[model samples]
Target: MGERPVRRSDELVELLERYAKEDGTRETEIPGLRFIRASRITEPVHSVYEPSLCVVAQGSKEVLLGEERYQYDPASYLTASVYLPITGQIMEASPDAPYLSVQLQLDMNQILEVIQAAEQAGKPKHESGRGLVVSRLGDSLLEAVLRLVRLLDTPEDIPVLAAGFIREIIYRVLQDEQNAAMKQFALLGSRAQRIAKVIERMNREFAQPLKVEELAEEARMSASSLYSYFREVTGMSPIQYQKQLRLQEARRLLLSEGLGAADAAYQVGYESPSHFSREYTRKFGLPPGRDLQRLRETLGR
Candidate 1:
């Protein structure tokens, strides 16, 4: 009798366990792919989820996008087709089993290349959808992911083979049932793509005060249309999105650069320290000073 095939999930768990030794994200030799392992349940982590695909091989995670909550496990994967401010927490983990996952950042140029080469069907016109999505994982997709992970063991083979494997993985994602949304996200002139451009500008200029009319003009849409489409893609108005980005950057400055709360606020374009403190407290459930203290304590810094 033939030997039984190894389950994809099992293979992924083994590969990740062998490679990942720490509790944070580890950059692999393969460009755009990272491995994450955490040994214990974690508090909510606020960060930007870039255009990427995240797959869980063990344990589960919950991600909060605006008012929406998405939970995924070994049987599902999360895809963010645009930059998004999000809160994520590991829902299930422990010392023995831990949480193992892989994050592959998506490249728009590569996605467009695949679409053009395949002559893929165009997406039908529809209302803009949220940029973040969770889809059930199929066996074929899981197999492709496993192959990509396996390439790490042979670093010499990576340069020549990684690109083709990565392309195949993305092709599998494009073939998912949610392909319509993905296609819209990549199409050059779609409203979603237009809104994505506006988001790019916001990220670059997040420290500045927002100008809604100017952003609408940049997107070539009416102010109201920009508002609607922006909210549809990001789950928040442009002002709210900018505020989130500012606050997140302020927190990073405080923690990573050892800046004081008031200085951090000023650095992120907040004019009133009191107003910044209030908003920071409201968003993070702790004042900036206390939050920074707790983070440092937890990180053993």
Candidate 2:
């Protein structure tokens, strides 16, 4: 009898574990590819998810965007159409079988190239949709992802072969039945793309007070329409979205710059230190000082 084929997900776990023994996210030799490994379940981590395709080889994860909750495992793949601030937690993991996953970041141009080349170029365009998508994994996609990872073992081939693999991955993702969201993010002047433009501006000017009317003008939508489509795409109101950015930046400042609570709050646009402490505690489950202390101790930094 012929030898039974190894499951793609199984081989994926072995490859990731061999390359990423450390229990943290690491960039790979292949550009735009990343490996994440963790031996145990971790606390909810507040961060931004950029445009990328994420495949979990082992364990499960829960991602919270606003009130929406998305969970996925090896059977499903997750893709982000645009940047979103979210809270993610590992729901299933252990030392004996750590959570292993690979992420390939997507560029807007690559997705546009696929959409233009494929038969979908003539499809009727839609305006807005959610930014995050979790869908069943197809065998072809799994095979393409595995080949991309396999390239790490042969560095010389990467110079010539990596681009084709990455292109194939993007092409497969765009070909999926539920890929409207991806299109909205890539097509010029799409409502979701317009909202994404507003989001980019917000990320750059998060420390300043939000001016919704100005943003609406930039997106070329009425203020009320912008509110509706923004919520549809981002799962949060514009105010809530800016708050997440502010809080995440404040956390970054406190840890990286050793800024005091008041200093960090002011820098991140909070008017009152007491208010900042309360809000930070609500978002992070601890006050800034305690949270920073716990994080420092955890990292021994």
- Per-residue CA lDDT of model 2 for 1-301, tens digit only, reads 1122247778899999999998999999998999999999998898999989999999999999999999998889999988899999999999999998999999988888888877555445555778988998888898899999999999999999999999899988887867767877787887777888898888888999999999999999899999999998889999999899999999999999999999999999999999999999999889999999998997789
Best by lDDT: 1
Q: Count the backbone clashes (under 3 Å) in each candidate.
A: 0, 0
Q: Pull out the clashing pairs in model 2.
A: none
Worst 10 residues of 1 by lDDT: 1-10
Best by TM-score: 1
For model 1, which pairs clash? none
Local accuracy of candidate 1 as per-residue lDDT tens digits, 33-58: 99999999999999999999999999
TM-score of 2: 0.94
In candidate 1, position 225 carries an lDDT of 95
TM-score of every candidate: 0.96, 0.94
lDDT of each: 0.89, 0.89
